[model samples]
Target: MPAESDLCSLLALGPRPGRDAREGACNHGQVTADEVFFREWQARAAGETRSLARARALAEVLGVLPAGVPVLVVVGSKGKGTAATYASACLAAAGLRVGTVTSPGLRGNRDRIRVNGQAVSEAEFASLAERLERAIGSLPPRTGGYLAPTGLFTLSGVVQARERGADALVLEAGMGGLGDEVSLFRPEVVAITPIFSEHVGVLGDTPAAIATEKAGVVDALTRHVVSAPQTPAVAEALERTVEARTRKKGLVEYVEIADVPQEHLPPGLVQRAAQVGCSAALRLLEGEGLALPDAERLEAVLSTVVLPGRLSWHRVPGADTEVLADCAINGTGVAMALVTARERWANIDHVVLCLPDHKDLDGAIAALGALPVTFVRLPYERLRFTRPLPSSWEVIEAAELTPDRLAGLGRHVVALGTVYFIGQILDLVDADTTRLFTAP
Candidate 1:
C-alpha cells in the first residue's frame, strides 16, 4: 500500500472520472483529494513542534496574496458559512461572478468551493489542488518561518477563485480570527455574523474572550468592519478591541449591523442577516463604481435566497413523516432551532438528536428538555467527541434504525443538532423504501 504522502500525491493528481489501476475504483467519478491532503496535513501538523502556532502562522502566510479583486471576509461564532453562501447567491443573482470558500463540506469535497452558487466540478478542484501544491512547494521559507500546506492550500483556493474571474470573493474565516487562514488576506470589507460560545479552549473560556478572538478579523480590514448584534459582553469586547486597533491605524471603519434595523431585515432573521451581508457587500461594490439593481430589486432577489441544512425540511420516503435537519449545535442555535421547529411543526411529537462532541451538551439537553417530546439519541459514530450527550435519551443503533421504527414512536421526527448526524440519518432513511407511508 502507498504511504499517506503518496496517497496525497495520487489524490492531488487531478480528478480522473473513471477507476484508476494505480488507485482503487473511483467513488462518484472522482476521489476527494482535498480531504486526503488535509487529513494527512493535519496529522503531520499535529505532530509538529508547535501545532496551533504553526497552523496559525501557516494560515497567515496563505492569507496574504496579490490583491485587486474585492473580497468579503465573514467571521463569527456561527452562521459564517450560511452568511457567505447568501452573499454569494445575492451577488450571483445581481449578475456578478462570485466565488465562495467554506469549510467542513456537507456532501462532497467540491462543496467547499463554489462559483456563482454552484460547486466547482471534481476535475476543477483536483487541478486547483495540484497547482496549489506546486505553488506552495516553490515558495521560499521566510526568516520568521512559513505556514504549513493546509493554510497554503486554503490561500491557493482563494487565489484560484480570483483567477477564475470572480468579481467578488466570499471568504469564511476558520474557527477564530487571530490564527485563522482567512485573516491573512486583508479584506476590503470584514463582516461578523453573530457571536456565540464555542471553541472555548482555543479562543478563550468565555464569550467575551471568544468575541475578542473573532474581532481579530476586524484588524485585518482595510476599509470597513460589519458586525452582527452581539451580546453585551461580546459587544464590549469587540468595541474595546476595535477601538484600541483603530486608534493605532485610523483606516478601519466599523459599521454596526444593528444600525440597519430589524425593519430593514428581510422577513426572517436568517434571511435578514444574509441581506445585511449583501447590503454591506453591495456598498463595497458601489464604492468601486460597480452597477447594481435598484434597492427594490435587490430586496426582491434576497427574498428568493435559500440556505439548506439550517431548518431544512424534507419528506421522508417510506413514512408520511417530515424530517428537519437544522445545523444548530450550540446553545443559541439550539434555541433558534427550537423556536423555528415549534413554529413550523406545531404537532411534532418526537425529536431525534445527534450532537457533535464540541457542542454545549448541557445547554442542548436543557433546550430539548423543555420541549414536550420524547427524545431518541441517534448514533454518534462520525462525531469526534461523544461523552456530553444526555444519559436518559434512548440510543438507536445503526442497523436497527428505520423510518418505520421512528414512526412507531411518534408522528413527526424532527432531527436537530449536528449537520453530520442529520446527513447520515437522512441517507439511511432515503435508501430504505420498505418503511413507506401507511396512513396519514
Candidate 2:
C-alpha cells in the first residue's frame, strides 16, 4: 500500500471536473484527502440522467451485479441513512454480516462505506480507489456527463462489501432514487422513509413527483417494501409506482407513527427511522423464510445505534458548551430538530445556521417562532445565504468557529445546515463518527 499522502496525490492526479473546478476545492477548515476526493467528485458529477448512464457503464465495467446477497435499497428525502443503518444493525444482530453505503459521510469519507459497523481500512479504500479509476478510464466515451460521486462511492462500497464477504447489503439513495447510482442493482427489498418536497427543481417540484422518482427503486426483483408514514400525495405516488413495477404481485407494508410503540423509540426522527428500518428487516427475513431473531436482541441493537448529525450531541474540548448538530436543510426538518432540542435541553441559547441559498429560510425562520435566541450564520461555498444578512445575527466564517469562540457564544447551541456543513462542525468538535452500528 502507498503512503497516505501518496494515495491522496494519486487520486488527485485526474483533471478537475466542472467549470472553475479549482474554486470548488475545500473552503472549510482542515479536511482529509478522502474528504477532498469527495468534494472534488461532487463537483464533477451533475446527477443527471446522463450521469446515471455513465454510472451504469462503470458498473458494467466492474461487473458488480447479481450481488450474491440479499440487497436492500433505502430511499427518501430524509432519514434514509438512519433507516439503512438500523436495518443493517437488525440484520447483523440476526447473524448476518451486513454492508451499508450512505451519502454525505459525517466524519470522514470512508465512513460512507462500512461492513458490520466497521469502516473499510485506508489500505482497502486505496486499493479499491485505484481499481475504480482504472475501470472508469477503460470505459468508452459517451454523451453522458461524469459519473456522480455518490454513485462512485456506492459502487466502491459494493466492491468493498463483496470483497469482505458481506451477507447482505443496504444502500441509501442520493437526492433522487430513480436517477441515483444505487438503482443500478435490482434489490430484493426497498425501504421508504417519509417523502417530502426536496430537490425541488431537479427531482420534481412537488412531493408526489419526488415520490415517483423514489419509487423507481422497486425493480422487478423486489419482493417486499416497507414505508414510513407519508402524505396522501406521496403515498399515492408510491402506491401507483409500486403497483406498476410489481404488477400487483408484491407486498407493501406501511409503518405509521402509532404503529411504533413509543416506549421502544429514542425520540426525534430516529423514531421514524427505527420503525421503518425494523419493518424492512422483518419483511426481508420473512421473504427469505428466515426465522426472526430474538425481539430483545433486535430492540437492543436499535436502542444502541448512534446516528450522527441527526440531533447528535458532542462536547468540544476546552469549551463549556455542548453542540447539538443536525443536518436539517428544510423547514420540516428544522422544525423537528427544534422540537427535539427543546425536549432534550431546557433552553437553547443559540441557533447556528449554515444553510444553502436554495434552502427554505423563510420557513425555517417561521419554525423558530418567538424563541428569544441568538442566530449565528456560518457561510460556506455551497452553503451560503441567498439574501442580505440580518442585522441582529452574528456571521462567522467556518474557519473561525473554534472551541474558544463557540464556548463564549453559549452553553447549549443548535447547529443546523446541510450534511456537508454539519460535517464541518463534527470535524471542528472532533466528534466520534467512526461507528454507526454495533454487532450483537
Candidate 3:
C-alpha cells in the first residue's frame, strides 16, 4: 500500500478543472489513510460509465467474493435500504449469517456495509480499502470505466461477507436498478419497492420509464419476486419486464396496501416496504425448503428493524426538545413525509429544509402548503458542493442547530433533506445508530 502522502496525491485525478469537485465526491480533511484513498478512488468515476463492467473488473482483480451464496437484490426509488435491512434481519433470525449493503450511511460511509446487522469494524474497513486500492491500481490502463463509490462499497461488502462466513447476501441498488453494479450478481430473489419519478434526465422522465429500468433486476436467476403496491403504469411496466426476463415458472407477487396491517408496522412509507421485504424473505426461505418461522416469531423479528431518518423521532441530547427527521431528497419524498407527519402528529409548527439547490424545491414547497419553512445554511465543511441559497427563503446558520436553540425556533419541527443532512441531525442528537437493526 502507498504511504499517506502518496495516497493524498491521488486527489489530483479528480474531475475536470472546471467541474465541481464535490459532485459525487467527499470532503477532504484530516481523514485516515483509507478515507483519503477511498475519496480519490471515488473521484476516478467522474464522467465515467455507471454500469456493471467496472465493478466486475474490480471483483475479478480482487477475487474475494464467494460464489453460490443465495443473494437477494432490492431495487426501487425509495425504501430500498429499509427493505433490504428488514430482509437481512429475517434471514439472520432464520439462523443464516447474512451480509447487507445499503447506501448513504446514517452515521458514516462505512455503516452502509454490514454483516448480521452490525456495521463493519473500522479496522476491517481500512484493510478492505487498502486491498481495493491495490486492485484498482493494478487494473489495466484500458479498463472501460472507473469504479464509483457505491460499486466499491458493494464489492467490499461482498468480500466482508465472505470473510465473515455469511450464508446469504442482500444488496440494495442505487437509484434505478438497470445496469447497476449490484445487477452483476445473480439473485435468488428480487424485491421491488414502490416506484416514483426521480433522476429525470439520467434514469427516465416518468415513473413508468423508471419502473421499466428497475424491473431489469428480475433476471432469469430470480426464481421468486415480491413487489410493493405500485402505480398502474409502474405495475404494468414491471409485469411486462418480468415476463420477458424470466420463464413462465417465475412467480411475481404484488403486495397490496391491505396486505400489511397498520397494527403490525410503524406509520408511513415503511409499511409498504416492510411487507415486501418480509414476504420476500419468507419466499426465499420456503424455496430453500427451510422450515418457516411462526407468524409471531416473524413479527417479533420485523418489529426490531428501524429505518433511520424516515419520519423517525429523536430527542435532542441533554435537552427537552424532540424533533422528527426525514431524509427527503426530492419533492415526492418530502410529500410523503408531510403526509406521515400530519397523520401521526396532527399539527406541525415548523419545517426545516437542508436540501441542495438541485433538489425539487418547487415540488417541496407545493407539498408544504403554506407551512412555516426555514432553510438551513450548511457550511462547506458539512457539504462541500452546493448552490447559493435563495434570497427569498428564510435562512438559519447550521451552527444554531443545537437542541435548546432548535426548540426555541419552534415547538414542533420537522427536519427534511438529503441522507447526509439527516445524518448530521442524528449525530447532533447522539442517536444510537449502531442499534438500528436491533431493539433498544
Candidate 4:
C-alpha cells in the first residue's frame, strides 16, 4: 500500500485511479487504495449531522443523476442493508440490471457498491472516480462539510447504472433519511425496515423522533413507501411524514413481517430481509409494469441470498470450529445476533463482541449478559471511533485469535461487531473457504 502522505497528496490532487498497486500507487481506487481516500473523507464527515444542504450541494456538483432510472431507497435502524441487498437480487432475478450502493461494508469499501451482485472491480471504481474528479474536488470544505465520499459513491452508483443500462438503482441510507445522502435521489419508493433508538444524540432521544428521521425518506417526490412491521411510535411517525410530504396523496404500505411467504425460508435474518425485501420489491415491480419472477424462482432466489454479518457463519480451512459473525450496529441488533446464535450452536464457549466507542455498549452488554458464555473484547483493527474495553470483559487482541487457539476452545466461537473488524479477523485467520467446510 502507498504511504498515507502519498495518498493524502493523491486525494488532494484529485483521485488518479487505474494505476497499478505494484507501482506503489493506489491501484485505480481499489479497496485498499480507496480506504486511504475514504479515511481522509471520514475525518471530514465523522460526527457531522446529516445535512440536506450538503446532499443537494454535492448533487449539484456531480450533476449525474440519471433520468428514468427507478430508485429504491431503504432507511431504518436495522435490516435496511439486507433489504437493499435482497431487493437488488430480486430485481436482477426478474431480469433487470441493478446498480447497488450500501454502507458499513461487510468486507471493504468495494462491497458498498455493486453491479448486480458483484463488487465494483478496481478498474471500474477508479475509472468512475477519475470521471467525476473535478466535481468531487470542487466541493467547498465546510466546518462539518458534506459527507463527500458518500455523495461521490452515490453519484458513482448512478453512473454505473447508466453505463450498465441498469433498469433500477438500489440505495441504502447512510443514516437517518431526513438529510441522508440517499434521500437526495428523490426515490420512486422508500422501504423502511424496523426502527430502533439509534443515533439518539443526532436523530433524537425518542422513538418518534428517530422514526421521523427515517420516514423523512418519503419526500414529496416519493410515489410509494413500503416497510416491514414497525413499532407503534415509529408507525405514527412515518404516517405523519407521509401525510405531510405526499405529492398527490401518495400511499404508505406497511407490510407486516408475518405476511411474507416463508415456508422455505432459511433460519436467519435473511428471512426477515426476504419478507420486507420481496414485499417492497413486488410493489416497485408491479408499479413499474416490470415482469415479476415466478413463485418457484423467487423462493429459490430468496433462499440463496447470503448477506454476510447478518447471523452469518463461515469456517477457516482446517479449523475445527466454525466462526459465526454479524455486523449488527446497535443493542437491538446485537440481541438479535445472540438469539440466532443460541438457535444455531449447541454449546457456545465464547461470544466475542466488538462495539464501537460510539455505540450503545450498555445495551449490548445487557443483551449478552444472559448467555452462558464469556465476553471477550477484541480490537477493531480499522481506523474509527472506538471506546476503551470495559473492565468487566476479558480483552483479546485481534492478532491473537489464531485458528489453533479457536479450535482449542472446543466449543462454538461466534464473532460479532464492525465489518472491518470481522474482515480483519478473517484475514488474520487466512480463512480459505474451499479447503474444507465445518458444519456450524
Candidate 5:
C-alpha cells in the first residue's frame, strides 16, 4: 500500500497496536501512523542547523500573504492572560473580529487559542497542525543541525488567524520580552502589565531584570506603547526602556491605574490592572477610528470580565464557605492573593493551603505570617515536592478533614495557592469522597 494509505490504516487501528507494531519502521522516516509520522518529522526537523532562523524564514513567507492585520501584544510579570482576554472581549464587544492566544491553558490545548471567545474547532486545529508539519519540511537545517518546530507551530497559528481575516491578533508573551516566540510579530499596540519576580532562570534574578525583559516587547514606536502602573523598580525600568527605544518612533502612553477614581478601581489591583487593559484597548480602537460607547458602559462590561485561575472564586456546596483559587506561584502573586483573600474574607479563621512545587514556600509562609489561623495542607499526589511541614506552621492531611470537622473549625475555609491543587480539591468535593485523606 502507499505510504499515506498505510499511515491512515495504522492510525485507524488505534494506539496500542500502532505503538507496538511501528517501532523501528516509524523512526527511519517510514510512515506507519500519523503520530509516528509526525514524531519522525519532528525528529528530522530537530536535526536541522538553525531552527529559529528557519522558523523566521517560514514566518517571513507567512507574513507576505495578503491577510495583514493589526496585532496587540500583552506582556507582564503576571495577569497577562487575563488582560489579553479582557482586551479580546472588549474588541469583540465593539464588533471587531479578534483572535487571542494565551499560554498555560486551564483545560485543553485548544483553550490556548480563541477567536472571539470561541475555541478553534478540532478539525481546524488538526488541519493547521498538518499544514504546519508540511511547512517545517521545507525549511533548511540550522547551524547546529537541528530544526526547531516550536516557532513553526507558533507561526502556523498566526497564519491561520490572519487567513481568517481577523481584525486584530491579541498575543500574550510566553516568557520574558525579547527572544520570546510571540515577539516575532510587530504588534500595533504593545501593553505591559505589572511586573514581579518570575521565571528567574529565563528572566533575570531581580524584579528589575524581569521588568527589563518584559519591557523588551516595546520596540521602536512604529506601534503604540501602553504602560500599566508598575512597582517603583519595574515602572522605572519600563519608562527608561520605552523612552530609549520609542522616543523618536511612535507614541508611548502610560495608563495610571491610580488615576482611575477609587470607585472605578474594582475591588482589587488585579481587577484594576484588567480595567487598565480595557482602557488601553479602547484607546487603541479609538485610534483605529472605532468609537467606544462611554466609560460607564465600558466599566459595566469590565466589571463582569472573569479570567479563570487568577483570583477566581467558587462556592462550596452545602455550605456558606467560598473557595478562592489564584495562580500564586511567585512572591508577587502570593502577596496579591493573600491581600485579596484577607480583604474579601476578613473574619475567616482557617485556610486550606496547597503549595505547588513552583511556588516560593518560604516567601509564602512569611507572607501569611500576619494572619492568625490554622493551615490544613490538601492531599495532592501530583506535587513534585511533598514533605512534612516546617516547625513554624501546622499541616493537616486533606483526608482527615470531614465536612462536619471542617464546619466545627470555622464558618469559612479559604483554599488558596496553586490552581491545580484547587482543582484536585474541587474534584474530591464533587465526588463527596474522603479520597484526599485515604489516598496517602
Candidate 6:
C-alpha cells in the first residue's frame, strides 16, 4: 500500500476521511434512516473483519421466528439477490405471501427488504427497526465488539413478514454461507446460485474451497436444495459437503441453465442466471407440494422480471449511443460484461469502470482485453471496495459522468463497476426512474 499522499497522487483523487467522509449512500441528497441504521453497523465494523463468532451471537439475538414459517436461504457468491427475487416473486405470484431479504440496495436500504415485491412503508420499517434496536440492546456485547447489519436487516424483514402474515421468507447471505448470518436460518429450502471467485481472502482462495463454504448453508434439517449450474470443481466440493446427507436422505438437486430456453426472458447473463435459480426453485416448490402458478401466469410474472445493474441496457437520450451498466466489481463479472458488450457492439470502443479500491483491479483491467478504459470513482464506504487507480486510465470524479461526457466516449459504451455508481448514473441519466434502470 502507498502512503496517503502517494495514493492520492497515483489515483489523481484523495481518499475521503474514512468514516466521516460520507454515509453509505449515493449523492442523491438526504440520508435515509435505513441508511443510518446500516451506518451503525459500519461504525461497529471499523478496522475489523466480521467473524463467525460475531455472526452467531447476532443471529442468536435475532433468531425469533413465527411458528411454521418457512425460510429459503439463497446462498452463493453472485446473483443471489436476483435469484431470491425471482423465487420470491414466482412463489408470491402463485398466491403465497413472500418476503425477501436482499443486500446492497438498488434504490436505498428500502430495497434491502421487501414483501410481495414491494418495499415496506417507511413507517413500518421504522417500527421494525425500533423493535430490532431494543432487542439488540438486550444482548451482551462481544468481547471485541461487532455488528451484523445484514443480520439485523434480515431479521427485521422476517419480523415484517410475520406481522404481515407471509407464507415464505427468502434470506440471502451477504458473504460466504458458512459464517454469514443466513447459516443460522432454519431453512426448509436452501437455494445456491452460481459460485464465483470472490471474497477469496475471507472465504477461501480456491473455487472448491469457496464451494465448501457455500455448501455449509445446507444442514441436517434442510429438506431440499436447489442449486444453479456450477463448474466441475465447484460441483465436487459441494457434493463432498452434501454427500452424507444425500446418501441418507436423497435430497440434492441441480438446475442447469443450458436446459432453460432464454427466448422469452430479457436477454442477458443475469436473466439467464435468474431463470436457472427460478427453475430449480420451482422444482423444489413442486416437490414440496406448493402449487406454483400456471404457465401463463408464470410467463406474465417472469416477463416483468427486472434485473438492475446486471448488463442492463439503455439508449441514452439525444444520442444514438447504446449504454449498458453493470455491477461487475470483480474480475469475472467485468470479464463477462465485456464479453456481452462485445457480443452486442461487435467492437466495444469505450469501457467506463468505477471499481472500488479492494477489487481485483489489475485482473479487471486485464479483463478489458484490448478495449480502452476510463476509471471513475463512486461512493465506496462500508459495503464493497475499490482498487487503487491505475496510472494508465483517465480518472474522473463520480460527478463528472454527465450525459454529454458519456455520449462522446463512443457510439457504444459499456459502463460497469459498483451498483452504487451504476445506480447513481441511472439517476443522472433519467428522472422518471421508477426501477433501478430507465425504460429503454
Give the alpha-carbon lDDT of every model: 0.57, 0.72, 0.70, 0.63, 0.56, 0.65
Give RMSD to native, each candidate.
8.0, 6.4, 6.4, 6.8, 10.3, 6.2
Local accuracy of candidate 2 as per-residue lDDT tens digits, 1-440: 00111121222222222111324543333134344334334444343233667777778787787677889999997788888887888888788888889876665567878998777766766777777777877877645365556777789899888888888899988667777777888888999988876666667879999899888888878998889878888888898999898787435678874333467555676678777886787778778887777878776766778877888998877788888889887777788998888887899888877665677777777777655334444432333455664556666655566556666768888888766667766766777788877787
TM-scores of all predicted structures: 0.75, 0.85, 0.82, 0.79, 0.69, 0.79
The backbone clash count of each candidate, in order, is 3, 0, 0, 2, 16, 6
- Judged by lDDT, which candidate is best? 2
Off by over 4 Å in 2: 1-50, 257-261, 369-384, 388-390
- Over the stretch 6-100, how does candidate 3's per-residue lDDT look in tens digits? 12123223221111221333334213523533553455543445436656777888674434588889998778877888788777767788888
TM for candidate 5 is: 0.69
What's the ranking of the predictions by TM-score, best on top?
Answer: 2, 3, 4, 6, 1, 5
Worst 10 residues of 3 by lDDT: 1-10
What 10-residue stretch in candidate 4 is worst by lDDT? Answer: 431-440
Question: What is the per-residue lDDT of model 1 for residues 329-382, given as tens digits with 9 covering 90 to 100?
Answer: 766666777677678766667777656455676777777874543333433332
- Superior by TM-score: candidate 1 or candidate 6: 6
Cα deviation in Å at residue 356, candidate 3? 4.1
Shift in Å, residue 206, candidate 4:
1.7
Give candidate 6 regions above 4 Å deviation.
1-32, 43-63, 244-250, 257-261, 315-322, 329-349, 356-372, 378-392, 402-404, 407-411, 430-440
Question: After aligning candidate 2 to the native by TM-score, how far in Å is the CA of 380 from where it should be?
Answer: 5.3
TM-score of 3: 0.82
Query: What global local distance difference test value does model 4 have?
Result: 0.63
Candidate 3: segments with Cα more than 4 A from true spot: 1-30, 33-42, 64-66, 142-144, 257-262, 329-349, 356-360, 366-370, 377-393, 397-404
